[model samples]
Target: MKKIALMGRSEAGKTTLTQALKGEKIHYHKTQYVNNFDVIIDTPGEYAQTHGLGHALALYAYEADIVGLLVASNEPYCLFPPCSTCTANREVIGIVTKIHAPDGKPERAASWLRLAGCKKIFYVDSKTQEGIPEILEYLKEDGDVLPWETKPEADGKKRANELPQEESQ
Candidate 1:
């Protein structure tokens, strides 16, 4: 299975994004599907610095072909963490969450996250499903850029929704 771990503060819509990607309502957990060449392991949301969540993240990365880090755009401190620590392994792609807002611009959001620590960036609305395909394409392109075989701890993705999640307590 290609493991994709979602990270954010609790209730940041990490779970919601995964469900929306599955084309389901935001009331379910642990759905599966066959992709071109991935088992697509989607796990429960991981809150920052939780040992269980961290362990789960490490385990998932250890088995992941790629990692997708989701960041809520509306959060004022979105890039405050500076970069994705787990993604330092170099396989992490980022998604800027809640792309559409009355005053929020996704392009600017994407740029900020890219600077935070992402070779590839996408803007997506987990609630409304905008930019999902674009996010997929970006991931595919990143994969294509990689060698035939990829190692673990290589990719990281997180998500946030409504307003972006605060970085620290």
Candidate 2:
């Protein structure tokens, strides 16, 4: 599985979602600093809320193959600027959480992420693990390309013998 970086505003369920993705029991732990797990990087919301700390996300993204920009369904506004993903080198995807909230408006939150330039979007309720499989599938497939994985040089076809050889130390 590819490592994912979770970034969002405070109380947006970043930690909760991280736990869900890891198949662990959800626990509330205030993320005062960046928490690096084997397959996830949970960032403090302040990093995304404070402009000065915002640059830290770019640095964190370097360590992840996927960057998840989360927005709660009931969020009143977006913290991210338009086309934010355009600045990221890694694949940036949007996640809309709290889909089960009474006042949840996942569509609105999704639109905000779309405006932020996320190439793909997912809507999920971390509490129930709804819609989580799609995210897992995406993470599994999207980042599976090996460094030496070869592509068709032409004609949209690649022969087995033409596969790029893995370098030996």
Candidate 3:
């Protein structure tokens, strides 16, 4: 699975999503620092909220193969601006949390992420495990292969662990 780094404002459910993805019992755990798991990096909301600490998120983004920009459906304003994903070198996806909130507007939140240049967006209610499987499936996909890494055999099968052998003189 690809390593994913989640960034969002406080109360956006980053921690809860992390727990759900790991199949752990959902519990309230305040994130005070960057929590690096095997395949997930859970960052504190303060890192994304405070201007001075925002740089830390960029640094952590490099550690992940994908960056997840999360926003609660009830948020009044979007923290990210238009085309913000252009700044990220890795793949950027959007996650709209709190889909089941009383006043949640998931579609609005999704539009904000779309304007911010998220290539893909997912709607999830961590409490109910909604949309969790899709994210897992995406992570399970194989990453891009370099052009020179391997070649398909005559049977159209690519060897997983073998590289092209150099020709002998």
Model 2 residue 167 CA deviation in Å:
32
Residue pairs clashing in model 2 are: none
Per-model TM-score on C-alpha atoms = 0.59, 0.82, 0.83
Q: Which is better, 1 or 2, measured by lDDT?
A: 2
- The list of candidate 1 runs beyond 4 A from truth reads 28-46, 49-55, 83-87, 103-112, 138-169
Worst 10 residues of 1 by lDDT: 30-39
For candidate 2, write residues 1-169 as lDDT tens digits. 8899999999999999988888789889899999999889999999999999999999999999999999999999999999989999999999999998998899999999999999799999988989787787777755454322345546766645454446322
For each of the candidates, the C-alpha root-mean-square deviation to the true structure, in angstroms, is: 15.5, 8.5, 8.0
Residue 139 local lDDT, model 3: 82
Candidate 3 local lDDT, residue 80: 91
Any runs in candidate 3 off by more than 4 Å, and if so which?
142-169
Q: Is candidate 2 or candidate 3 better by TM-score?
A: 3
Better candidate number, 1 or 3, judged by lDDT: 3
Reference-based lDDT, each prediction: 0.56, 0.88, 0.91
Error at 151, model 2, angstroms: 34
C-alpha lDDT (0 to 100) for residue 157 of candidate 1: 29
* Tens digits of per-residue lDDT for model 3, 25-111: 999999999999988999999998999999999999999999999999999998999999999999999999999999999999999
